[model samples]
Target: MAATRQALDWPYPPFEIPAELYAAWDARAHGAAAEAAWQRRFDAYAAAHPALAAAFERRMRGELQPALAAQLPALLDAAAARTDAVATRKASQLALDALAPLVPELFGGSADLTGSNLTNFKGCVIAGRDRWGNHLSYGVREFGMAAIMNGIALHGGYIPYGGTFLTFSDYSRNAIRMAALMKQRVIHVFTHDSIGLGEDGPTHQSVEHVPSLRLIPHLDVWRPADALETLVAWAAALQRRDGPSALCLSRQNLPVVTQRAHADGAARGGYVLRDMAGARAVILATGSEVSIALQAQALLADAGVPTRVVSMPSTTVFDRQDAAYQDAVLPPDMPAVAVEAAHPDFWRKYVGRRGRVVGIDRFGESAPAPALYAHFGLTAAHVADAVRAVLGTGAECAA
Candidate 1:
């Protein structure tokens, strides 16, 4: 080939370079010049349209919409006052319905699970070609929906979120990682967060999704216990401009356990829900498990164990709190038992060496929610046993 090229005098002093090749070589410069020219035009337009330009700039900075900010306090108050039992997902729907109208930049939809995810709100027009809309129908594309949310966030002027089953977070894991790496404020609504999703089988249940999502740096994972906590989580996710957030919601109804006075404490990620006088041990739990922990506290109190229940909705946020707050919530001197219907490994850090964890390290089985709880030993009885074990009052339970 070399001899043939020499014979043809290819690209040497005897041959000229192709015009197309030269044009191709110059394309980068041309593109740069074009971009500079477009920027200059944009600058001139911005100068002429100062107010619009300022709004655009502010949106890119991820500033909360002024109107939305004004309405947040009252909306949160209303959400906190809700005393009826409701699933966290439904509570999220109510929150979105109330806030979406005020925050025009809040745009989101589910991955073809709108009915189950409860992500769509009233007045959210479907996005279509040649017309802008607030909500997008992501259509059963979990990974695609997450990637697209990242794009929307990176493009600016909108906060984007998407929903899917917590078990399917595996399919969107890489995209979630990218969102975290980019520090985009993309919200992921993961419903049916645990085996409590019931009768869906182990295939549909999320045994480790909560801890898995929590492992990702810069990604805030929240498993709210009740309607008020869910509202606070949603608010925190929207207000978080520097990172992504995962809201782990339950399918079963959760009663409003945290009183209105302490409801806002959800923003702190972990807070004392029920404190008992002369408490020697603390029960830490999240999501549906928080209610179980509360029940366990009552059981322990009846047994003269004197236990406290700490609702830890978001470990990521709690870790960011001051040492004093952390110590106050999970005291060093007091024994603690962490409870969740997922992996136990992550809880070992909060619960000291002597402390026990009430969780299912193995896959779940097909059964009713109550049966699953009994089989998996996730009931208040089990949590109370674990608390007693941690306090050296009883033998260690088989959790």
Candidate 2:
């Protein structure tokens, strides 16, 4: 009948003569007056409870509590001073432990991987039906956890975050996209971020997840090189109020690369960790691959290549930098090599047409991490070889 009506010259013959229908319309027309009456009552209540009203306003504004802001500097300083090798996930937990107690509004949990993800901090009680707690035990539901975090962010009292393996981000991708679209300040901590998470086989390894997450617009993706970088990344995520963030962390321990005194460069997203005068090539790397790049720079230096190493923890942040800073870090004329354990596609932007990328293009193996790295050719030797190859080609063409 609806289809036949659409085909007819007049789709509908308007007729509303029922007294009940007119009464329903009258009630609907008073909705604006009803809302105004409720607003007047709320205003009276707010005036009677000024302190509660102020707190409510602050939460609605998504402002960090003053106490939390005051403690951030000391926490960042403590994180920078730590020099021991540790997993970035562990570093993130330590930072969370210190900050969560100070910042009551920072709430997070893991998708049944708290021990592996290290997302649960000390003094964090599990949330229950009767009362709210700072931490949530999300069980094994990755998608549910992400959606819940998005809800918390959108509602605006808490800075919501959650954790899962990097490989499983595919499950929570749509929710992450929703948070980005709404410009919510949600954080996603993805551990076991690469083939470095070995012995678990190819099913758990994250070969393309990093690049995949980086592709999302307005979402800050960070693959911190070490404990200090992880701390900095966490601080950055908390400060960012306009977008969501993803922190790609590793299961294996990483050596400290940035010191407390020299850690400011990390805030810029990419920094020259080691520089050489009259450098012929620049080596860019993130996460565990950065240590490999440093080693490769040493090898190239010994071979008279004069290479520089730049640690780029956050490509999204780096892209927002001014053209002059970008050019200074990655000179247009210099031959470059990017070393990452993930896919090679995104590295092309910084490395350029003539440059090379040392990355994994296939699934990982079931062996130990060292063996898997060797099997996939993700090592200082491979990165050095790529650098040498690019420089050699440039030299040959010039000759």
Candidate 3:
């Protein structure tokens, strides 16, 4: 091979040369020259792009920033003022609309589901064949989009993100795993998170995706409840530098059940959203089901069964919290019940032996979201009933 390479002039490494000579040549000449040239180019680029250079510097310094985090309260306040329910995906878009302009290092795109994913916002420019742009138009290719975002994150100088339906995350599974394994800061926007994405049927429903993604070590899976939680999820994804984040958003509109005061606790991954005197049980929920849990809380109150509601958006993050905080939020002695529009098995660990999970363990049908929720027993009354069952009280207990 060496002789053939020499003859063909393929520029193979010079094994015939003395080891000392090659080492000395590269250390004093080739390597030094390359380092100097690269340094000069880097300095030029930094001078040309001050904002981007600063963003990279902040990232390298591990500055989990609060400046951007401080702005979240105002956004939450704005969301609370709105009377209508908002889809978490659309809420995420509103968040991006406010924060994207401030983050020059943020580069995002959608896998040909731009309208549905709401990843692209106003003032966004698509990367063309010739010149570079902030966003990509990854057409109908979930795996390709995820892999390319991984490549971009590996290359540095930009925070890469991509969007697709929650069910389609299966296609990007390997790439998403690689991101978690490498501890890369890549964000995945997975909308249509549950049977709430009605009419799409079982093929498009994401019954197991959120829990499956949570099983990935080092990856943060956030199923935010409302606009405020959605913004917090986005901010958390941006601040995290050691691992990837998956934002499992909702298709159906979620009532603004959260308040501005919950912002700090929300960032903790889980917090008690509603506390009641003489509470006999705790109801844990995420995403669209959070509102349902709140409604269940009301029903339980009316039924003379006091219960507290805990909005647990990110179980991975919650698990990382201090034992004191975890215990404070979820006491071991308390009977707990979890409600979500996904697989039931994932909640079993949290709910304990005495508790139960109100979730869909079967395939969804094509129908309106409300009808699906009703058929699947994902309603507030069902959750209230679950709490009653866990507490050993039946319908007769409701006054």
RMSD in Å for model 1: 4.0
Q: In terms of lDDT, which candidate is stronger, 1 or 2?
A: 1
Give a tens-digit lDDT track for model 2, residues 1-399.
676757864444567445765786786558888999988987988999988777767777887678777877787788878888999999989978877776667888999998899999888878878978878889899999999999999888889999999999999999999999999999999999998888999999999999989999999999998877888898889889999999999999988877665456677789888999999899999999999998888877776779889999999998999999988988889999999999998899988888999899988889899899888888888888888788873321110
**What would you estimate as the lDDT of candidate 2?**
0.87
Per residue, candidate 1 scores C-alpha lDDT tens digits across 306-391 of: 88889999999999999999998889998999999999999989997889999999998888998999999998889888887766
Q: Would you list the C-alpha lDDT of every candidate in the order shown?
A: 0.88, 0.87, 0.89
TM-score of 3: 0.89
Sort all candidates by lDDT, best to worst: 3, 1, 2
Model 3 CA lDDT for position 87 = 96
Off by over 4 Å in 2: 1-53, 393-399
RMSD of each: 4.0, 4.1, 4.2
Q: What TM-score do all the candidates reach, one by one?
A: 0.89, 0.89, 0.89
* Number of backbone-clashing residue pairs for each candidate, in the order shown: 0, 0, 0
